[model samples]
Target chain A: MREFVPPSTRFVDLPDGFAMHRGGTLHGARIAYETLGRLNAARDNVILILTGLSADAHSASHADDPSPGWWEAMLGPGKPIDTNSWYVVCINSLGSCKGSTGPASVNPRTGERYRLDFPSLCIEDIADAAASTVHALGFERLACVIGTSMGGMSALSLLARHPGIARTHINVSGAVHALPFSIAFRSLQREAIRRDPHWNRGHYDAESYPRHGMLTARKLGMITYRSPREWEDRFGRARTERGLRTTDEPFAPDFEVESFLESHAHRFLRGFDPNSYLYLSYCMDQFDLGESCGSTTGEALSRMDLEKALVIGVETDILFPLRQQHDIAAGLSSGGTDVQFLPVDSPQGHDAFLSDPDRFGPPISKFLSVG
Target chain B: MREFVPPSTRFVDLPDGFAMHRGGTLHGARIAYETLGRLNAARDNVILILTGLSADAHSASHADDPSPGWWEAMLGPGKPIDTNSWYVVCINSLGSCKGSTGPASVNPRTGERYRLDFPSLCIEDIADAAASTVHALGFERLACVIGTSMGGMSALSLLARHPGIARTHINVSGAVHALPFSIAFRSLQREAIRRDPHWNRGHYDAESYPRHGMLTARKLGMITYRSPREWEDRFGRARTERGLRTTDEPFAPDFEVESFLESHAHRFLRGFDPNSYLYLSYCMDQFDLGESCGSTTGEALSRMDLEKALVIGVETDILFPLRQQHDIAAGLSSGGTDVQFLPVDSPQGHDAFLSDPDRFGPPISKFLSVG
Candidate 1:
């Protein structure tokens, strides 16, 4: 499959023979990013925004791309990470297909899509790549670095591996390492894709894409991304107008929630490359902040140098529970960083930071303004 | 693809032209069951056991079948159910493959497996079949009806439709109707099975079985059956001896939890018919006590004539959360039935009743002793 890059996305080529964290090198590789607002003369008013899995650098619309981006509500002028006051740079994670050099990208060395031939990706690699992009943008130090979900893990890695890269950090719904439950879910999702005959060891074309596998994976993800209580209130045993007998299959979508999942899964099918998904998901399961530094999670977190930090978590997020956020706060505070942990009671679960901007926007804006 | 019946199971044939709850007629349908201990001349000491999806009539070992049954720890001569004091009868659910006339059973008229040709099964049909079995045993009423998970829904239906059939009821981790979250998960599971090319619209033979689909479905079920906290304690980032690179596929099972799911899924693949799984899973999602009687769930539950009731729920059970069990208790109490709602603190989630017998057994034994 081909990469899905927005026309307005800008690129920053890595120096030749860029070394990957888990032992591999990429030649002629580049990072995709989009910047809004202008850096001040001193570049001290900059904010770097790192995203979670499946997001692109196009976080919000700029003059180049007027269309709204994924996190449009929380970005843009006068928004949470206000472009009016802070020059914001959003970098697409290295292993994603959204304009970044991932498995979907053509390998310069072999002139073929990397696919399984791509070196194993890791969270540290994604962090390092983002760090490289920061340096390439002529910034000696970022005023603040914001990371959400998987990007939260990347931010921690950046703060630890490349010390003094940012003055302050915002960790949102992120974890130092994946819990066993999350690993099991991701493992099964990868299995679903690999088991699809059309997947064919990542050699699938558009005609034989793993549609069913991707659908199943995305549906499972949708089930986990939102809280059960939210689903209960929104769709309590509600039936869909498309009756169960609409098809020859006896187990057709009957409940409204089933239809909801079907539409969401279908929308995601063509947008992502299955190989890139496998690589990034497996990378998350393998990420361990403590293991990277050869220390305990608390010890590794305590070694980071930051003036201040803000950690936000949702009460209903099953994927990255509140306790993980608490750990992040406690660890950073131990290192003499002024840390503020805000646990929001949003029923949207892990995806609350994206969907419920009202609950997430205030604290983020307040933190950046004070910084 | 065929019925998997225990050698010691007994059968009770339904009367000719037996009607199903959803709409259909079965000419030679039968219910499978097994009994232990002796019923007194008054037949007032009889207890009927209704099982959840995937269980058979062989709930516990009998004189003829020495093999330990699913509930062997809790049902025996001196066990929680205490067969020596109360004669116990365990009935295989109507649409299950274990010694019951489900989709896997042969049709009397066509001499072929019913498969998709089988009528759409409902919880009420399973309840009605159990009621028929009880009457066949010459019992006017059961001293108590014990149901767990899906069986909990069936027991409610039996008590409501066949008034005075069961004097008391024990609902374990059951719901009046499936929540949207639970429905979404079950829908994905069914999709996994149906999307398998080998399924062939339920016409798969032994050589062409949908193994991958069933494996995915079973693994998903295993993940939801237990609590995340339990997995965190049991297998936190533990790696298996088998390396990730052992297979050509990069996404192979590497974590201990993934291995746990794989072994469990493989063990279940050949034991049950895939068609039966699709039927029973859909049945559970479709079951709503309120809709069955054209009343609200609370109203339908309040109409049941029970002298005593015990509702048990595990705090961590995502499938049938404690709130659902509380509703059952409240509804039953409104009808003037003495109700005890026990919320277990076991970390076993929905399967706590099966795995944490010490916590679950005491309440069950005490309730039966006083029933």
Candidate 2:
């Protein structure tokens, strides 16, 4: 039950000129984070957990609040990550709405929020941020890195972008390349935000920032996060006398999906920013982990020491299809790395990583512990 | 390939007042329709294709245009239904947005659109509209009645509401009863409409309406009509970068699905009315074709005197799952009816009935033409 009794919080000053992997640069960027459990004497007992699209560093556990962390089930004391034995750290990635330096982060030079003026970023920059964050965390070398979905992507990007961050790296439900379909859906979400009329060309600050866009984004995200069969089985076109409490009346789905959207919207808005959503979704569209490589998948694997990395995929995950994991495993094994390819089955779809760790946790634990 | 060849004009007038299944009365209502194909000399060669959700009788091909109909590939001059042999007819149901007399229809008494004043309609009432429309066409008995999704529902309701219309039936991706989860989703869609400020209590009357509400409804419908796997595999976080013309932008989905939604929305808005969309959605939610005099599945099957029914369900048809089609087949089989269940493999979800008929048409053609 005790997920990571977080050690403490610290602030790190960005270099005088923080140039992006893209073109532009920023100055005086201060990043903040907290650590959990302890780094072993060898300092090899560290597992980095990167947050997803909208989540903060509070992935493990939180103090001053009884509510368990987002990944509470597996990261607790005596649990899989077993903070009692290993040091677990979660970082709020750059360009997020959380207390990190993002669109919401103040620009001391301009004294205004970054907004869209914030330099466009790719996952490589995110990997860089994580690398810098870890280095700032006083770790010389690491044991493993674990991330789910976007976070999984961040982990993969880190491994590809930064060398030797960990001996073994784990990426769950992520792919080496961004598929067109995913990029298309992300485009629609971004379009929804852009079309909000209220978006005011990305200058709409903290006060407004397109509520409709936020709602539409969450609704769209819900489409990707869960399985269609799950939604249909849970809430198909249901019957009602009064129809939609809206004007359409009783003709459409009063199905459970409405509730799912509403609940998801409410839970998300409390902790997210519109600009960050737009920026991150755009970044996802740009993700190409394979772009860093040689001619073939084999070359890509050869580029990375695959035997040291663990690849996890959710059977029902459509976003990052299991085929991609198989590809990764093939690449890793081709590269002469003993890749632990594990696909956990669940009806939860792309969300299985967060929902079911019974299968996901054990291998991660064994891989991290046995060695 | 002569498909739905609608008559110069098709019309049906209610001779007198009609009693309804939901204990209501409609004082002289008329239903309008369009027909494709030609009836045979025996008239028993009649095949009825029921319209789904807010559809009209324009199922197959147009009249003078003579292109293709709603079920274009399945019903043609020499196709499966073989306008050359069996007469294929589709009719607009009562309470629909087609030319039929619905809430939008002008009431003969006051010459005003029915609006909310229209009495609540049961599936039986909708079935009655189909029966009356078909009877007006001078058909004594139908060889078979085929339905997909909501149309399948109407076909079942017609069997119960009217006596001996068709001996053979195909309930494709539909159910006799509305499940609880189905009810819940419909409830949320209706709620979204009701909560929209512009609905103006359903009196939008074409001047203005809650376009946002209708948009939301369509968006939600988009979710149900398709699958997450398709979304993930096709458009997961993909986007089109700005100023992109030739190439399908970097962030946007080059996936076929993005085009699918765009086309779906375009067709939906042009071909359908917002108010009718709302009302029809509500009506479908109320449909429950479970049991009347049947104690068990056997009894329920016994209640249906179907000679043979081809229960076609798409593997990806989430709204009306394959399991439901199996249940229909199971119940019908128990009652001694010759039943065959076919699962159409597709990723299009419920829309497979209309969109991916290449896979659907062949099996259906074989099933009907076997005789």
The prediction achieving the highest lDDT against the true structure is 1
Tens-digit per-residue lDDT, A292-339, candidate 1: 988888888877779999999999998888999999999999888999
Q: Write one digit per residue (lDDT tens) for candidate 2, span B154-212.
A: 88777765646788888878877655444444544565555456666666645566655
- Model 1: lDDT equals 0.89
For each of the candidates, what fraction of the native contacts does it recover?
A: 0.94, 0.30
Give per-model CA RMSD.
1.1, 5.0
Deviating ranges (above 4 Å) for candidate 2: A1-9, A62-67, A178-209, A228-257, A292-298, B1-9, B15-28, B108-111, B114-122, B138-140, B177-260, B291-301, B346-349
Give one digit per residue, the lDDT tens place, for model 2 in A233-263: 5565442345334533434334455656766
Residue A233 local lDDT, model 2: 56
Candidate 2, residue B2: Cα displacement in angstroms equals 27
Residue B289 C-alpha lDDT in model 2: 65
After best superposition, candidate 2 residue A317: deviation in angstroms?
2.8
Best by TM-score: 1
CAPRI grade, predicted model 1: high
Question: Highest DockQ, which number?
Answer: 1
